[model samples]
Target: MNKWEILNHAETACYQEEREVLVRGDRRWITALHYAFQDDNYLYLAMDYCVGGDLLTLLGKFGDHIPEEMAQFYLAEIVMAIDSVHKLGYVHRDIKPDNILLTADGHVKLGDFGSCLRLQEDGMVHSSLAVGTPDYLSPEILRALESREGYGPECDWWALGICAFEMLFGSTPFYAESLPETYGKILHFQEHFEFPPLAAAVSAEGRSLIQGLICEPQERLGAGGALDFWGHPFFSGVHWATLHHCTPPYQPTVSNGTDTSNFDVVDDCLSRMEALSGMRGSQPAGAHLAFVGYSYMATGETKDCSRDTVMSTDKQQSGDSEGLIRDNLLTESVSEELPKPFEHHLVLSKGPAGHVHGDDTDLDAAMTMELHRQLQEAEQRSRGLEEEIRQLQGELESLRARRLTELNIHEPHLFLPAHRLDATGDGKLAPPACHYPLVIRLHRHLLLFHRVWRPGVTGESYLLVCAAGVELQAWSRQQSAELS
Candidate 1:
């Protein structure tokens, strides 16, 4: 397969896996996946747009650490989120602050399940891949990679411990400059993990909870379930049953449901990730069948109710140039299949009605028209760039010609050698005598001038100029001989 096909295949596999994990419907603490679909070259997942951004952004707003009470509020919700995932027999192998999203009301929602894996019948996963943030990775996960063993959901609890420490202490407990050092610290956490003196303000109960979570996997706090942490002193006032309904310790300031002010705008374009090497070659038969049953739709929603609203709002908020560039990029991404009419098949449908309302035919038509228009604009831009490049090249050649004209006018002697061509008995011009080394110098000067002043001119043209000069000299010599 080509790079584009390889990327599409790898992304489709990931999309299918994440869709399977999230198609379970809306959970209070988990980010809800509203819908999913795939075109010829792209996969689309419409999920909840958390206005308050991720926990990492929230921590940055608070100078990298929050008060113990605020940490407890968010961590409690994260605990429930992890428990929900475990209940479904999947392990969230890559839990970190960046994956923890917050709603406008400051409630936590776990997101980004690209690394999620379902447990086998043994209630354990046997992957050798150490799939998680370096500092938050449990020692058992690293050991599993080395020993080719299995690990359970307890690794997530270990990550929760790292999150707790960072929330209170402003850093992970086992962080090091290098991956090996970080793994070493995690493996021997008894000597490496210690609360700093600067964290004196953190309560003893908070430290105890961190200790319980960052301990051995067999002794981790959430081994039983999220209910295991209900009695922890750090969560003393928390009502676990009604945590989502209760008021949070803090509320993010957002003007609208689509506001992204809480998040950092990293780039105006999507990332161009390297394609997977393993997918290079002809795809196996029925490879597309793997994503056959991956379609889903939420109940009571006739269409993507938020899509148009969000797009219009973003257009209004962003500059016209930026929006145009973004639209053109998105158009080019799927332009490979533009020659053929696009088709979408909902192989599987969820919800009580088992189908979506409204006519999708009109929607597809409208989307196709917009894509064609954007593609046209992108082509126009490309043509304009090519024209600009040609103009620059022409101007450069003119400048070189002007420089050569000035050199010829002021330093004509540079083109001549202190040598005379001799005539043979038949009156044809002969080569300059080898004793005149200046002939070589003249040839070098002529070559440099030809290349710099007229790069498009051929060496044959230079030879013709030399031949004409030689013929003139030979005619003068014949006339001198006739006079004698």
Candidate 2:
């Protein structure tokens, strides 16, 4: 009988968008986001059962780079997934091994829209701020932040390139000791990087695809847009229209929906919370923020959670915080009731042993000593990059993904043209220009929207739409005088 208190409208907008995207029921790459709801206090989301867990879990099981044939299948599916996301006019900023979940039947579904950015409908794409996993963060995103500029969906392709590298090599392409160093390598990698032996074994064409995607923003393979990346020879054999129908290269063996063997501790915890939906408690003692969404079965009916909850849920007594947190999706633990973080990270020993330093007999006997010395240093940097990959993985496990929509949360632009009045002067201000679509030149200041009721169906039923704007005239005047 507990509940979550809802506050910010923008946060709800994000949660709703995520739910809607999933509910679209696109079989090619979409996951099932069953429902979203809210009481006076908390938001609840129910998603589909991906019993096979995530790609990262499968990687850990293999103890190294997955076989190239299997990696190819996943990488191709990811491309199709990215295509679907773009078609929806959103950029999934976080597309890594963890976010790509697997079904028991062995297909991929792209979930986790917490880091998504919706582009403006009128062809004017805007970038607010940088976000996403450090290991997969695109170079242009980092550069845009440094230059105080904006970015677009191209960032996702760069990340796709990183995903490809991790799949084939079990390490990132630009791994470094620190964030800045890693970013620098990303910016300069085009002129310098080459496929290591582990990756080269996949195919020269595959390496070329990565090289093209992992370049500077202007020259990036996906900069031309989604179709360009799909056309790459790396996916030469792929028939996009039928990928969903074809058998997945590796299908997870699922005994039941409750299976957690493929998942890590963090994923297992969430899976456990999801399983424990029945005894879902009342509003926690002091929590306020709540998430909300709308969901249904493919038939468009609200699912019968009563029966499902009783069957899938755990018997453990519900904790105070668990009511609001229907799903433990964040990478970091949100409360003490959650299990401790794992200490060990699975690593790939799939390094190109002796690939860099071939036998001296193969070296030209007449070759200059200086050339040999440079080769040795290059090998060392490669090794350094791999070690740094391990560190980045650790960092991924430690960080928490923030719930609030950090970008443009405040309505900085305060003025709109008089003729474009959606409000009839109840004096309430409009929402943020960067967020709310606009036809007028933007002016920065405070404006609040007012809700007014009017008869729609002989006043029988109603819509709770904001009907007017009531700008705070006196405060604006006072602030203007102070600025002077």
Candidate with maximal TM-score:
1
Residues 42-135, candidate 2, lDDT per residue (tens digit)?
A: 4566766676789988887777468767877788778768777776777788888899888655678887886676777653245545577887
Residue 467 lDDT, candidate 1, scale 0-100: 37
In the range 28-93, model 1's lDDT, one tens digit per residue, is 667777777764444567887877788888899899999988999989888988988888888888
State how far residue 141 of model 1 sits from its true place (Å).
0.9
* Candidate 1 lDDT score relative to the true structure: 0.67
For lDDT, the strongest prediction is: 1
| Candidate 1 local lDDT, residue 24 | 74
| Off by more than 4 A, model 2 | 1-13, 121-125, 197-199, 223-226, 229-231, 267-484
Off by over 4 Å in 1: 1-14, 273-285, 301-484
